[model samples]
Target: MQIFARITSPATQSLTTYRPTPSTISFTVSTRPVPRTLPARLLFYLSILVRIILGILALALLWAKWRITFPIEGDISKGVRAELTTWVLGSSAGQAATRISTRLQWRLLIPGALGVLWGVCRRGYTEESLLVLSGLGIQTSTSSPTYLSTATTRFIPTTSIQDIFIHEAFKGFEVRFYLAIVVQGEEDVVVVFPNLLPRRRILEEVWRGARACLHELQPKSKF
Candidate 1:
């Protein structure tokens, strides 16, 4: 079985070592990934395309000659905080011009809203958790151990581990992977990493490490 001896933890910003019962296999799962595969590269390009479309729509609004007023501006620690207030002035052509102005505002706002939503959803993909396998059972924790009450920290016996697999899936705008540890009579435990390391290598290494750990434990043996 393939084993990664030293793996870096993106959450705690430290190296993590796993030596379960003398037979040790470990690897780090970081965010940055190398996508060389066809489908992986395709997804990466698709995400870029989405971002470009959003940017074009934003530029179109700016080019419409809307009156912009900065109603709020202040000094902060290193920069100034400001708000851009934009509006369209009705032309002298009467009610028809007024209607057009209102319509333009709605048109700009609709695409703007979609862009914001897309960005928010994309950023939500970064969440952190760690998994440790040992002789007696599997231990999981958030990097912040003191926040155990609010985090996922637990020990599941080897027998209780129902399904174990590495999920190489796209989360939002990123193509990240996670160790999906499903336990019997319990919800699955997913150890996800932030986007801070090589993507494909981490996926392959983590999958190999997790599989090695599971192989040693022999938890009903699911791929």
Candidate 2:
């Protein structure tokens, strides 16, 4: 990964306390991007009985969809089919129910519901990243655990950036260092890597690199 953005200046490096102030910080901070793929270790919250009920309902739906003659039909089996068949009447009603069940069955709902449940139970990030483009704006992104959801993002144009600073704040009982951006026309500063607020040294690295790339520095970027 590109950790720093310093220009080679023979005189600049040798001279102490000179124009560049040691370095400029440009921040395209990072945390690994979360993969949308289902994790190898996943937890399911449904009780065994509830899951069995769902499975029976699924089997029943398959029976209806393909017109299988069932050996047994119970609350666990006919649960969904019986409910939908309630809407209309006749021998053809079963056919209608079968048609509707094809669309509403567990084939689609299980995966979707499981995805939502996974997101709720596993409250953590998969990926978080920041990107800085010279003379352009910067972009920050956060990846969600579930592929069903989109990544959250924001972009701040270069012209709207007032300053980038490192701030110390108390999270719980301890102080933490975080990189923040001063955006034009915004009262509250934008925080970088808010979730993964790394250590001071890391922030310092990003802070210097971000500034170096975005602004002209001491010794003034000589040719």
Task: Give Cα-based local distance difference scores for all models.
Answer: 0.50, 0.60
Cα lDDT of model 1 by residue, 122-153, tens digit: 53222343454544456554433222125445
Instruction: Please list the residue runs of candidate 2 whose C-alpha ends up more than 4 Å from where it truly belongs after superposition.
Output: 1-124, 216-223
Top-TM-score candidate index: 2
TM-score, cand. 2 vs. native? 0.48
Q: Give the alpha carbon lDDT tens digit for every residue of 125-190 in model 2.
A: 355566666667778777666555777899898899999999999999989888899999999999
Residue 38, model 2, lDDT: 54
> Between which residue pairs do clashes occur in model 1?
31-195, 31-196, 31-197, 32-197, 32-198, 32-199, 33-199
**TM-score of every candidate:** 0.36, 0.48
Ten contiguous residues minimizing lDDT sum, candidate 2: 9-18
